[model samples]
Target: MKTLSKMHGPARERGVVLLFCLIILVVLLAGGVAVMRSMDTSLAGAGNLAFKRDLVNQGELAIAKAMREFNASGALAATGATSNNVAAANYSAVQLATNAQGIPEVLLKKTDLNGPDVLGNTFRPTGTPISGSGGSTVRYVIDRMCNATGTFASIGKSGCVYTPSKTETPGGDQSQLATPGPSVPSPPIYRVSVRVDGPRDTQVFLQASFTKPE
Candidate 1:
């Protein structure tokens, strides 16, 4: 009888040990699952950030392109030239104007503004506003100008200006002026503003100024 009791006691202890081992295994499995889920969430967030950054960059590039086109037109030579041309077709007359100084005054077209009043005045992009795989879109605004001093200025909304050198001798040759007499600095550099919209309500803005080629 004593031997049977001892055997029974050992069997009970073994059963208890087995049960504890099963519980420990279940806890470990749960921890592993939780860790895996956390890693997945982190990866997804990283992907989204990258997507937003790319969209913003694309928007900035679009603004730059528009500024370049503006500089190609000689509209910057004269002050009071409205960047918006409702009469010219596609804004072409305004997009590609050249003054006597051979300066172009092509300013960026605002997305809010309609196309030029006349046909053939507007600048149409072949393939712009590239949408990314992450469901993002980009928009751009470019405002640029070159002043008479050969300095470039880009104002965002207001217009730009260029001033001719003042004649030093009351009536002497204007071209021979030793120094530019007191004169207002040319208008501010043209500015290009870009906006990018991404999935999940993500938005970004980027801006650049138009500069004359070195």
Candidate 2:
């Protein structure tokens, strides 16, 4: 019998084993890469959700602030010297002017906290009486008062409404008389509405109604 050469026999077998080990390493590397990619995608989605939740919270706070201002302005009162409930009109007009003028002052009027008449950017509905808070990324309208009463109660009518157009939706209609005994009368109630654009073409709406404070 012929003796087999040790180098040709065992050495060749060792080379084959080395090749198999290399292939296994390559496969593990590919699997690791896939896992890493999946993790990255999950992280991105979580980040986006967190950002959106933050925006919603900011919007809700903005509405509350606007309600406080509306109460303070005496604009929501039934008997006040300058109680026009024209917050929506005034703010809309100002915003229109700013959009047309492209002046920093105009934008600042609605955005600046120290501006003369800090609540100048509020939106007041005529019949509904909506108010708003400024200085937020998204604009909102909150109505704290309404002029409706009697059998045709206007409790549900009081709330917020989003107005992207130059012209906003008018608030609830007031009753001509008080105490709808023979005829329907309107009493003053309150409403709050909020509108926000998370991004271009993305809009959200929120509305609520409250009884007028005694």
Candidate 3:
């Protein structure tokens, strides 16, 4: 009876050892899985941020290009569409809706604006890049700073915003120059609104109040 009791005790000890090993193994596996999931979440977050930066770059490029074209129009591009056919179609309408703050605001979808005047203009780059922003499409709008839409002449709105550059000229005070001291009219500020649509559901909007002499 003593020998039989000793054998049963040994068997019980072995079973306890086996159970502890299984619990340790399970804990290790759970820890490994948690680490993998954390890494995946971090990677996804980084990817999203990179895509957003790309979208912003695209929007800024479009706005700058549009401003250049606007400044180059020496003779003042005609108001109506088809008359002034630059690289991209030109529109003379203020399509951007503003909030109570009176600042221009719009999401600016590519599908609608890519077509005609009511939506604004599509930004067409002069040359394609070797590698681009994942084939993003950028659209832009240029609004002549005026109170209402239509010919500025008809609305009695002045296109030019004059800010005299008061500087000392070679001849005495610059302001005290001859009566007709070369009527150098300062350029008017135009609203350049640009929106970029990227491949990874990224959208970006940028605006610059550009001014250049005619």
Global lDDT scores for all candidate models: 0.47, 0.42, 0.53
lDDT of model number 2: 0.42
* Residue lDDT tens for model 2, 1-214: 9998765434334478789999999999999999999999999899878756766675675456555554645344334312333443222211211223332122232333111122344333322222323333555543333232221132232322222122222342235324333322233334444545454344444545444323
Error of 1 at 149 (Å): 22
* Deviation in Å, model 1, residue 131 alpha carbon: 6.3
Candidate 1 TM-score, true structure as reference: 0.47
| lDDT, model 1, position 37 | 96
Q: Which candidate is the best by TM-score?
A: 3
Candidate 3 lDDT over 1-214, as tens digits, reads 4555433433334578789899999999999999999999999999888888878877777665565554446223433331232333333343335545443443343353333232354333222212246798776656555444444334332433333434324443566655535535444456666667677666666777754443
Sequence-dependent TM-score of model 2: 0.43
Q: Ten-residue segment with the worst summed lDDT in candidate 2? A: 90-99
Candidate 1, residues 28-121, lDDT tens digits: the string is 9999999999999999999878776687666765665555454535443344443343222222222333334322222233333333211224
- What TM-score do all the candidates reach, one by one? 0.47, 0.43, 0.56
- Please identify which of the two predictions, 1 or 3, would achieve the higher lDDT against the true structure: 3
Off by over 4 Å in 1: 1-11, 74-136, 142-184, 198-202, 209-214
Ranking by TM-score: 3, 1, 2
